[model samples]
Target: MNPLPQNMENALTGSQSSHASLRDVHSINPTQLMARIESYEGREKKGISDVRRTFCLFVTFDLLFVTLLWIIELNVNGGIENTLEKEVVQYDYYSSYFDIFLLAVFRFKVLILAYAVCRLRHWWAIALTTAVTSAFLLAKVILSKLFSQGAFGYVLPIISFILAWIETWFLDFKVLPQEAEEENRLLIVQDASERAALIPGGLSDGQFYSPPESEAV
Candidate 1:
């Protein structure tokens, strides 16, 4: 049987060494295995640039916008005191963007935890927030007497609905997807390079090679 060419032997050796190191890593634990699988090669680039800023701003705006709408609607509904007397003190929860504002605040804090603390770059966080917000807002729009108020009442729900959808679109289509793709792409690296060689020579693909004097057995 013919011996492997020098380049082929070197490539095989390099591959085996890498695999051996990986095997040692896997023997340790599952966490170590995951860490070594990507070798943290692209961890620093897992998410998009300014992901923290963009996502925080989005949640901030959501909370603020809902609060603004609640304030205006509150005044139109005879101020917070009257509304609380009727909506809360009377053992009934009313819809005037107040509940949405509270929900937005809660959602903001949770999203901050997911993105800033846990460093999740996936769309799940934003998708979940959007879904819940939409459901609540939709239910309120249906049950509430906002249409009897004026243009402001009509516009409030409409704007809130639009904003919630916009948030989903921004994350699912643009920010989160790009970050997720980057992370996934990095994790999808090949086990070994097909063109790797220990000794560099002007060798083209599919060409036969002779063993050099230094590498010959």
Candidate 2:
């Protein structure tokens, strides 16, 4: 075949260079990969907000039930008055103290839940709160068994435990992952901007590239 014209050869060379540059631009950069992962994680978390809210409601109900139980116990057994009674004692101290302590713990857990609700972006708070609530529920179940309590008393704790467990799972697998991904995306953008700033004549318009300037005649 005849040799290509000089302009055609130059055009072919420029096209190949342009194609290579495009490939470089389109290649999977680590930062872009992380951004994509974050997007997926955020999507996953979006579907679980309702589940988290349901768990929060369950926890609220459990707190109310425990409070009512505490009041009833105190009324029936003369809370502090029956401290020395064998049937009234649950832990090492007075049953009244136990009731108070349990109430305080439940209230703290409720506060955590409220914080989580007000600041849903804070996955750590939700995770910590759910973990503590689950622990309390487990303890309640064990104590009930030790004391030979009726099935009715076991019901609330069991349900609360299951809900807490589910909440924790959502926090770990969905909420937390999404939060981490968002942080990663922010970091990547910040890094890109910073890098762009350092480049000579670079235009930091949310990207890491320098704009082309017109050649002088």
Highest TM-score model number: 1
Worst 10 residues of 1 by lDDT: 190-199
> Candidate 1 regions off by >4 Å?
1-48, 76-96, 181-217
**Off by more than 4 A, model 2:** 1-151, 198-217
Clashing pairs in 2: none
lDDT for predicted candidate 2 compared with the true structure? 0.52
lDDT of 2 by residue, 1-217 (tens): 4444555656666766776664444443555655665665575566544445555565566566655655554445545356325433545421122533364356447544553445456556655666776666556555545234344354445545565565566556765566576667766755654554444552332443333432333
Error of 2 at 113 (Å): 10
Q: Relative to the unseen true structure, what is the Cα RMSD of model 1?
A: 10.3
RMSD of each: 10.3, 10.7
